[model samples]
Target: MNSTLSNNPAVVIGIDLAKTHCDVVGYDKNQKIVLKLPRISKEKLLERLTNMPRATVLMEACGGSHSFIRKVKALGHDGRLVNPGDVKRIRCGHQKNNMLDAAYIAWAWYIPGISFVAPKTQAQQDLQSLQRIYQGYMKTRIEFGNRIHALLLEYGLSSPQTSRFIAEQLPEFIETHTKDLTPLAEEALLMLRDSWLEASEWEKKAGQKYDELVRANEDSKRLMTIPGIGPKCAGALLTHCGEASRFRDSRQFAASLGLVPRQNSTGDRDTLGHITKRGPKHPRSMLVQGASALMIMADRLEGALGEWVRKIKASGKKYGVKVCAIAAKLALFCDTKDPTRTVNKKPTSAVTKVSGIFG
Candidate 1:
């Protein structure tokens, strides 16, 4: 450790993190750079931070950022993950390097109204990882299934649209009509089918793991109380948002998830555009899917939520917009309604207000 760093403890520190190296810049209360450690190993970085006086640590939200924040918090220091965009907005000069980036992060820390990401817990990260794996497997399965369908169609053999149906029936069809397909084509179809089956199994296992995690979590249980949300959807939202209490209100919470529309307004003029699509993709996707399912079963839905859905549909909004509205409404519902206390109670004023917006 440098003498200056050891003697004059920094009030704020910024770290530019990479896979193997980190650049650290520290500022005193006067905003003067007092400590600059360029190119330190992760272990060395932790060791130095462990010894330093507690200070606010700023870093970009990126790979391993949450884990690093956890470690920083454990060391009795304040750790905040700033959005990269926020840092970019406040960045001063064109010249950029690891050390300069760290310095800029330090500067951004003092800027008011800069949004920061909450560090996720280990369990939340685990659930997110599982969800991502499941999505990957699902994509692979779909792609392989599509390829198999196209290949079969080339041979004038049509299979059912269902993945399971295709996976099961295609092999038998190929074996029976082995003469119909060229040897190369027959072998290729069999190989693709096998890959699809494997991917499907992996997808199923990942989904089961996700469900088990959701079922074991208390927050997820409460989230599942919403009409459209199930175990998977609830798990996604809980893991993505971490804590709903961080949001000032349900509307802000919904907007954070990008379920709300973008707005541009001037005196006497206002314009609303499409859904921002700005947050974690998985959570937004899950919410939209859940809301769409509820819309499909709108006739069966009964209550203020059902009535709101009908009103939106009758208003002749595009189908996608209606679904986004429902998703935003659902987020508001989840944020305001406590399952433990309000599970049996009627819809509250929050729900009414949300419905009024769309009504």
Candidate 2:
């Protein structure tokens, strides 16, 4: 490592980080690539960067980049994620290798209108870890449920497939048909029944664990008070929102989640497309599911908003399109905490307020 570049001269470093070795490139304010180094171990990399007085560091947002970003930031330097997509488009007259890629990121860091990723905090990372475990268990559980349904179909015993039905009815069906089933089939059925039970238990544990995390955070509790946001959604949002104050407005937060529509305009012609789906997926999925649940519950009661949603559905749009619209509005409303952001000015439905009822 060179100490000359480590001093207080303004420099931009683009790091191509890997598990063991990192490729680094340093550039001056004038965009001249002054130093290029081969792979260095993590300790050596940190020592070099820490020795440097201060510099803007750029790295792609990837698995290792998350912790590395935090580590670099702690050393009193700016660490930014250069979207791999944008970096992909900028290679010219140079070999496409780690060194060149790093150099490009350094150059891209200072570009106009480029947004930098907000580093997540330690607490946020822990929440994310819990969410990942929960998400994995839930996904596997869904798979297990599907397997049970498929197995039953082989026995000419098809039932309406659902998580609840699998949890409650599948075991009873297996027990009742024990005498008729072959020894091997009976064993398999019992195993699947136990698997479903395990999945259910894991799901419950995940929820309880997440609830504890959510309850501990006052901001998450405040978020839960909003419609269509539950413990899981609130916890995920609070965890993922690395600095809610970093966002100038709730609209920016919504846009970051890709909840906002895409726009296209050419010479007085304007076309708006679906959501960009550009940010953390867990929040978006949770928000959409919450909106769908609210919509379903609201439909059971005759209400102004439900009636309005019915009208929209009756207008020939698919039910999913309507659900997505509601979800987007729900996200916006929750993010802003401004009642005025609601798309419909009508009174809230009975079931619409059930989220608040949880309190």
Query: Each prediction's Cα lDDT score?
Result: 0.81, 0.74
Return the clash pairs for model 1, or none. none
- Which residue runs of candidate 2 sit more than 4 Å off their true CA positions? 1-10, 91-95, 163-172, 175-180, 299-316, 334-359
Reference-based TM-score of each model? 0.90, 0.83
Error of 1 at 140 (Å): 1.5
TM-score of candidate 2 to 2 decimals = 0.83
lDDT of 2 by residue, 73-160 (tens): 9999988887777787666556788777877888887678887777777788889888888888888788887887777778777777
lDDT per residue as tens, model 1, 1-359? 33355457799999999999899999998888899999888888899999988999999999999998899999999999988987776674577899899989888878877778989999889988998898999999999999998998998888787976766677778888877799999889889988999999999999998899888876666566677888888877877776556776667878888988889999999999998887788788889999899889988777667788878877887899888988887887753543322222364532333222111
Best by TM-score: 1
